[model samples]
Target: MSSASSARSGLRGRTVVVPLIPCPRCQATVRYYVSNTEDHEGWVFYRCPNHSATGCDFWFWEMEYVAYLVDAHFLVGNQAVDAVGATEERREELIRASYERRRIATQVATSRAALARPGSLQQNMSKHQESALIGLGAEILVLLKLLLGSVMLLCALCVLLLMKK
Candidate 1:
C-alpha cells in the first residue's frame, strides 16, 4: 500500500467526520485520521491535510484537541466531546454559556483590580473607601461561590454521564 493509504488503513466507512478545527500551520481545515500502526492502532487524531502536500506538520490526539477547544472557549469543559455533534440549538446554548463564563471572568478581574488599587493600603482608609472595599470583597465572594457551584454541578453531571456510558 502507498504510505498515505497505509497511514489511513484504520479508517473505514463508519468513521465519522470530526468537527472543523483549523490547522495552526496551514490555515486549512484539519483532517481527523486514525492510526493504523501497531503501537497506536485505532487512535484518533487530527492532522494537517496530507502533510506531504501541505508541508504542515500540525498534529494532535483527539483528547488534546478537546482540551485546546476548551481553552480557546470554542467548547465548554463539560460539553467538549458531545459538542462535536451538537445540534444548532445546542451550539447556540454553548455559545451563550461561553459568553456568560467570559462575562463573569471579566467581572472578577475588574473587582480584583479595584481591590488592588495602588496606594489604597499605604494611606488611611476613609469610611466611604472602607465601605467600597467591603462591598467589593462581598461581590468577589459571591462570584467565587457561583463559580464553585457551577464546577461542582458539572462534575456531578459528568459522573452521571460516565455511569450511563
Candidate 2:
C-alpha cells in the first residue's frame, strides 16, 4: 500500500488517551487531545482550557510525569512512574511565534493610537476644517448629479434621433 493509504488505515484503527495534568506554575487543569499515537512516536502537549486572557502556561509529558503531577494535586490517589516523556522542541517554537505575534499586534495598536491623537492630521479635525471638507464634498456631489443628468439627456436625444430615422 502507498504511504498515504497506510497512514489513513493507521489513523482509522488507533485508540489512545493521554491524561492531562494541572500547570505547576499556575495550578490550572490543562486539557489535551491526541492527534497521533505512541507507536507513531507522537508527543502530546497539555493546554490550559481557561479563559484566553488569563490562562495558565503549563505543558508536560503525557506518559510519565502527568499521572504523578495529578497525584500531587490530591485529586488522584496514586503515584506513577518517574520517567519523563520525550519533549517536542516544536512546542517552544510555537510559543515564541505566539509571543512575537502578540508583540507585533501591541506595536500596531500603539502606532494607531498615536496617529489618532488630537494634533494628528489623520484624526480629530477642527470644526472649521470639518465644515470646509463638508462644503467641498457637497460641491462634488452637485457636480456629479449635473454630469449624470446631462449624460441621460444626451442618451435620450440619441435614441429619439435614431427612432426618427
Report, for every candidate in turn, its global Cα lDDT versus the true structure.
Answer: 0.62, 0.51
Estimate, for each residue in 102-157, the C-alpha lDDT of model 1 and write its tens digit. 79989999977877896564433676688899999999999999999999999999
Q: Who wins the TM-score comparison?
A: 1
Q: Model 2 over residues 35-150: C-alpha lDDT tens digits?
A: 35423233444456563657554544444334445456522332222122222233354457667767998999998888777777443567668889999999999999999999
Deviation of model 1 at 131, angstroms:
99
Q: What TM-score does each of the candidates earn?
A: 0.37, 0.31
Error of 1 at 130 (Å): 99
Count clashes in each candidate, considering only residues at least 3 apart in sequence or on different chains: 0, 0
Error of 1 at 117 (Å): 80
Residue pair clashes in candidate 1 = none
Model 1 Cα displacement at 124 (Å)? Answer: 98
